[model samples]
Target: MVASSLISTNFLFSSPLFPPRSPIRKLTIVSLHKIPTPSSSHVKPHKRSLLPCRPLCPPCLNKLLLTTRNPFSFALDSLLILCTSLALSLSLLVADVDSASAFVVTPQRKLQTDELATVRLFQENTPSVVYITNLAARQDAFTLDVFEVPQGSGSGFVWDKGGNIVTNYHVIRGASDLRVTLADQSTFDAKVVGFDQDKDVAVLHVDAPKDKLRPIPIGVSADLLVGQKVFAIGNPFGLDHTLTTGVISGLRREISSAATGRPIQDVIQTDAAINPGNSGGPLLDSAGSLIGINTAIYSPSGASSGVGFSIPVDTVNGIVDQLVKFGKVTRPILGIKFAPDQSVEQLGVSGVLVLDAPANGPAGKAGLLPTKRDSYGRLILGDIITSVNGKKVTNGSDLYRILDQCHVGDKVIVEVLRGDQKEKIPVVLEPKADES
Candidate 1:
């Protein structure tokens, strides 16, 4: 009974209201009898606590409360974090797109007036320009097969709707086959119709469709003034339809033909870029009309040197017309041979020295005397022609050039120096005899 009372007292001391002063404080209550164990073997035994039960500290109690949180609140927090990440990613993508759009630039859609005119000129005339290729036949040494090989290239333009094309004669000289490529890149075999070696002009015919042919507008070179703006269109170095522009640097210039040793008179000079492949191309005026034909460039490096020469269209017009009508030029001739220009210049003479005059010829019928060597081996000077129709005859070339302006039936006054007497003679022009 006393032990029971002591246990009840211990329970009361351990209660929440009446706690012990020290956490390690122990209660020593004496028991009168020992507790008996349970008799049933199947009954489980209760486990005794090793540590004394105590109330949790303030920090541990707060941690326990936080661990047992509401599951719904945790789920809401996770959703909020995911939403923030997606919003940041979307904002960054929007910024990148804005930066890219800011860097984009728009192109210009309009051109200046001069720029527009140049563009229009090229577009209008490019269709009329054509590319010419010269091919030569060569036999392969090993295969023993004859094949046409490309020898050179040049440029040309349409002359008429009949498929006639005009280019430099040197471009087609010695070529086994000729090929012409149109502006549309359509290539056709060309046949040589006629060529003037002295004028360096050639006429070719291609059986191309009439619709593909666009003739260049013709212009007169007679009135072309120096410093007038000009344009050149050609296949420069095989590059088709290239255009170069400059002013007319000079007029009435002369250059010798590569085909013939004769001089090509009345040539037009320009600063336009005329290269190798531009030999047969057309030089046009600001109106996009053909004014000249680009034939050569005065360059040592085989490139443009700001000194390019062209055959004036005025000369081309007459020569081409004659070539189309006749297979060759029918130049009026004075049937008398004269000494070389070098010989006359060395002798310090002012007129053409008549070397020979054939019997029954115009010069002979006009009683023009020829130089002779007497039996004493002394030189006898012949009739020296001083002028033709008031035009001074300085040399053989000058005399021939003047006669070229006259027709076969035309009459001209010829002034000659016979010994110490000056005489005027009348002579009728005649066709030149065919050269053997």
Candidate 2:
């Protein structure tokens, strides 16, 4: 190592071992010293550098030592700040994306002309719907005479200017009298003109003035599609003049009426809120035409469960036209009591089973055979009818509905199932008594 040169005693010396100064030189060194007195009350700036260290050292050397000792402190603080800023930025970006996705943005050009027409139709048809109240005469046993009591309330609409109001038969069930209240708060006493219990339909004649009757425009239900927009207007739970909107959830549903054992076929199902009092209300298409009658709701709580059922307008029109003209529903029927259409496994048979046939009925007169017992007294399943009028009968309801298209006296071709063979038989249909 090269020896560092030191200035001492006003002389340049290479090392301590190189030379020793005389006493006179040492006294000169003491006189050249500006070292502070140890007992000094104040520390002076001149004393700071004079004691031990070199005054010629660079300032960068001291800075390098400080950084080397606790290097992570400053770096750690900077890293934390940078990480915090990045987290905040990510959070803001996520929030923006979520807000953008929450809404469905539809352009006006996306809607078809037919959609607009449907919306206009619903707007126009909502007003013609009316609320119906059924008042029954409940006789007190002590009094022994009939008097009026509010039995239930439902919905209905004016059929025509002839003062006829049409509604579901179940609407006025067990009621001795009926009344109709129009949208204008006009109340009128209604008389039961005709009722078809099997179809769950009834018509009431309210002798209101001609102007009080605003008939709803009827619509054909054959063209309804699932997810089509529909509206319901009725007095739900006696809350008068309530309007509910929803999509046609389903179609061609078979619903049974409790008032009648027969099934109401081709039922329309919707998501609109149909409650207790909305039973007879009109379900309107987009053009405000009456497409269905809002009748039953699928709810465990007996309220609007968003799943509601309606009587299709096609069924209502056919029944109501007959009821108003004939004082009864003109429902056609196949003249045989076939087994209830169920799975073959459920019926314990490979074909449709004949449970009963009226002796004087069409099937009886056609020589269609009934089931008989064996010699050992074992029961044998009867001849199963599989079709009527050349239409294949899948079940009992199918047969009934197919027969409903025919008049009472019309002849129909019937198909029957025998042991290992299918046979066709001609039966002359007969008029049957009305089952009310």
Candidate 3:
């Protein structure tokens, strides 16, 4: 390789690039060489020789270039080539050695404080959590064979070793058949013992063996504080028992009942994930005790969006006790039908307008007036209840709320607006025949 400014190093030995052998050393200096073009007028007219200046006696990097026939230069180049080939072979071997054993696994370590506690909580409580499947009867399109198919799913907890279970009312709603599955994968047929649509609480009885029933520890939600840690366990999306952790985001939340469309007061609000199938699952506090029942979520897509409502355990205890003993919620009734809140509002009235007071009912026995039609085909307004006892009554909800706190046979003052005067009448509450 002979060129200007580069030592013609050995054209002395056969070149792997330039070829042939010459006694003299030769080398190329390609960086300094530029062919002159006639089209470029700025080009210098004087031309330099290809080998402008001598580089060195042996040439630049002679051993690496193998420009000389010296034994040392030849030997050095051969050794370098052998090392490169060996490195490439080793790289190929490593690329092909992708076996599972090559990936070293780190040894297991002890669980963290919070992690261990959570793990224990789930393990101890899982036996109490049960899966519920709401079944619907479906007829085969072609065969016309009728069979029961799963329509929906939710979660529940064991109420006692007597095979009694507690869940949300909406969970088993509209079911043609119901099934309850225990934590051990054992299933049992379930029957509805009692339910309260207004409070959205339902009690189911399963005949599983006593050994499979593990009653959950009950806790009061009345003393729960916001920002306290909470846990939710349920079979969301028909999956197995899953655990979600969050804090009590709010307290004393009021939400409407899904079945009765009535207001459930003092509800618990949490951010723990509550999805479609988590309706009847228990919401536990940090102590792994049941605090509330996960009910509804505030999401547009029917998925969890952080906002969830739970029926408070304090309220649930009373309802469950009544249901377990009587198989129904026994509450005193006024034995009268009243106008809707919207209708009373439309009449510019601020009280519940008595629609009907049956002659055999308590309201009629107390001398309460009822709306009627006259011979002239004209409507006559009756007594408009202004309050029950001393509490103000503005709507049907208010009246129901007040009466729910009262008992049967309890005498109370019922204020009414009859014509242009106000009168207070004493009425004894009576139990509804169905509830009785």
Evaluate all candidate structures by whole-model CA lDDT and list the values in order: 0.83, 0.75, 0.85
Candidate 2 C-alpha lDDT tens digits along 1-436: 0111111312222222224454222111222334435576685545333213344234434433433446376456545555655565566667767877777575656668967765566456545778888898877899799789898898888889898998888888888878888878888888898998877889999888888787888899999999998988888879867777889999999878868667788999999888788888899877688899887878876656758999999999988998898888655554566565664448655445776777877777887877779999997877887787778766767766777678766778888887768888888766555533
The segments of candidate 3 whose C-alpha lies over 4 angstroms from its true place after superposition are: 1-112, 138-145
Model 1 C-alpha RMSD to native: 16.2
Per-residue lDDT of 147-196 in model 1, one digit per residue for the tens? 99999999999999989899999999999999999999999999988887
CA deviation > 4 Å runs, candidate 1 = 1-102, 137-147, 300-303, 371-380
Cα TM-score per model:
0.72, 0.67, 0.72
Tell how far residue 44 is off in model 3, in angstroms.
Answer: 82
Candidate 2 — worst ten consecutive residues by lDDT sum?
Answer: 1-10
lDDT sort, best first: 3, 1, 2
Query: Which residue pairs of candidate 2 clash?
Result: 121-286, 121-287, 121-288, 122-286, 122-288, 155-280, 169-200, 169-201
lDDT digits (tens) for residues 1-436 of candidate 3: 1131122233223334444455335444433434444688897766554443344234344533454467676666656655655565566556556543468665787899998999999999999999999999999999999999988999999988999999999999999899999999999999999999889999999988898899999999889999999999999998999999999999988888999787788888999989878899999998999999999998877657759999999989999998989999877778788888898899998999998999888899999999999999899999999999989999887887888799888998999999989999999999887776
- Report the C-alpha displacement of residue 390, candidate 1, in angstroms: 1.4
